[model samples]
Target: MESKDLVSDDGRITYRSGVAARLAGLSPETLRVWERRYNLSNVERSARGQRLYSAEQVRRLSLLKQLVDQGHAIGVLAPMSVDRLQELAGAAAGRPKAAGPLKVGVVGANLARRIAASNRDGSDLVVQHSWSHLDQVALTSPLADVEVLVIELSELHDSALPLILSAARACDGAAVVVLYRFCASATIRALRAHACLAARVPADVGELLSLCRSALAGDRLPPAPPLPTSDLRFDEDALFNIMASGSGLACECPKHLADLLLMVGSFERYSAQCASRNEDDAQLHNELGRAAGQARVILEAAMERLARADGLPLPPGLIK
Candidate 1:
């Protein structure tokens, strides 16, 4: 196999087995063996059963050879899906586009600026304007064009949720991530019942940025409804009626409490798995206990800070 054997055709290419072997920096026999053993090559065959190589295939083979030269195991890469292989190659070539943070028309300037500032290094779109500006953005922007919406409903005259819902209707598939300061569970539940998407963002810019990033990345758990409206105290009858209605008690107030419930649900899953598995029962129990305890500590610390920032006393019953 030699370099001179390589021939090009109008940006297309045809490879003699020997030439492909040379381009791949492998012996012709080794090339055939790779084709048979790993199915790694994307070579096509002419009607005469002669193998033909496209330029793309040649480039891929060259990349594969480079990876092998770098001590990567060919066997490990042999079964990679084409998409995964391309992603790896793109990453190696630094081709992945790093679009700045997805934009949002944040309703509250102070909170919006703080959240945007926190996510300076990550991707985000920050809108600093009045609620009316938010409405205009949502109504006129291309549908589902934005990934998340951060609105401060507490300061608004009209119900923010309706605007959000209208935006959600316009956007259709886009996620409407609402930001709330202090809202009752009933309000949150009402929003969720209408199938609006929302998440609880801490007052801290850092935490809010993290929340927004996770939401935009589709990596966070599906959020619960907004926090319970603070001013409204529901009577038992009212609570019971809400509970017996559609969505059941699980969707009831303190909308973001769903995050807690979901976290516990995960713990329950691991607990069940440990109980079902026969090996290392004691070790598993200890490991789970430690993880849960650590999580509890972190949650408590954050809750204390959040309580202070919001100027709200932590409900005694809410502390776990």
Candidate 2:
């Protein structure tokens, strides 16, 4: 079987033998012999009992023929698993399926091809000379339901980070993963804080492929859009009245920002609860720093200014 023999008609695979033979550069008789001797393909039979091969089967057989030409024994190769064989074939031919182990897009088609070769599957792939290609597909292709954004990401200046963040923010179901050669702790923190993901991986295609695969498999869904002002504005009487009675202030902030603050406050509450357990100077200092830093940042600019005006500049060095 050869790739060209399988025609897609109304989303169904229709096969033709003469065409397969012409594309494979072998006689139809040889294909039949391989099928009968090796049980190689899951060939379908038409209403008249003529043999037909699905697109996958055709692609596999084409690789098998090439491997045979390269002096690999068919009998020895036949025992290997289909996936392993396809991996080898995809490597050799550079025509990986879009929905493979990982989906990737690179700035250049050659880069995408190279990455695809190392990664070994293409569930959904698009190659572009620039970011505009990705933007176009994302705008128009229904199949471009991306979950992870993988890029070589070198030569990206500092100015691009905020733009990248905005794109990731717009990808409702996607998690952006940058494959960069050089990274620092500051970069990592910025990425996480902005809800983007990134990793430092090898320049080799294989590592890039593996990173993308792992990222897509574990990527989180994008957070929902912020509610409208009316929806987000809460009636404090319902939830905060009780807190006020307990000596807590009623706070108002964006929902997401509030959640971030509460995460920071949780650590403070934990430290306060455990003040008796770990009485070391470093432990108390660490907890206090984290709590104060979170509290100040969580406040609106006006409130923060007011607090500073009131002489709450915080201790010299802290998480803030």
Candidate 3:
């Protein structure tokens, strides 16, 4: 076919028989044979009599080839529309599904409430819990076997990756989607390395869903890390319940513990990030992290003692 014959008279794009066959994973001889024998493909001919196929024709031909390869007879499938062929192929493959609502724990700008309200029907995605700030997340446990965690923020830096990672670690290694207003490509790559995906927002529900699907389908979730000994002593729900229960108290004990928890938690996170980010000062940051972890252990002891004395109810894991 001549170069000029690749397009048709209607100003629509088209491909010659050879290109079309290659694109549809068929040989020109097979395409011609099918056209001659079964009228499987409709092709326009240039004035020079070279066959031309439109993109739609190519697409249909591709689907026909797919269904045929899947053991369907070409005679029966060639009559099916693109949508029906798609449905058939999907059913044959069991359709890609995340299955059930993708429960998400969130930290950023009341995102949990927003996502929860959007998914009141519970068919797709659900909010496990929403924390307005990462500080709230750092001080308490919020992950509840969620499959995804959405972190919304204005900007993301390398320093922030450890915090985000820590939250993911705490979430049983839920896939992470970081929606930000500004993020560098390098940081996005770094996020990807840690099995976190990043996108700039104002992403709507559809875009967010797409990113979430990619995060899930990519098998990007890291294995859930082992919980620290301190974590084994108290689960998130217990900490959250205790903190809420103590809000009514005038003792100021929980307040003090909350502050300590936040400080040490932040420092432990900071030190760990520092160690990872700085090779020159690795010893210093690792030492800082260990010291901070010890401080957190002491605080946890105080919290457990306080919770028991205040008659706070613990989650089933801690009840015994």
Give the TM-score of each candidate.
0.32, 0.30, 0.40
Which tens-of-lDDT digit does each residue in 202-308 have in candidate 1? 64555555555544443211222222223222322222222223342343333233244324333533443443443556456445544654564554445445444
Q: Residue by residue across 135-248, what tens digits does model 3's lDDT show?
A: 566565646577788888654566688788778877776778888654556777778667676776543465676767656544221112322434635543455455555554
Which ranges of candidate 2 are over 4 A from the true structure? 1-100, 107-110, 117-144, 219-320
lDDT of 2 by residue, 94-200 (tens): 53222553333443223454444443344334332224333333443332455456544432324456656555544544546665434444655566455445665
- Candidate 3 collision pairs: none
| lDDT of all predictions | 0.51, 0.48, 0.68
- For model 3, how big is the CA root-mean-square deviation? 17.7
Output the lDDT of residue 226, model 3.
Answer: 23
Top model number, TM-score: 3
Ranking of candidates on TM-score, top first: 3, 1, 2
RMSD of each: 16.9, 22.7, 17.7
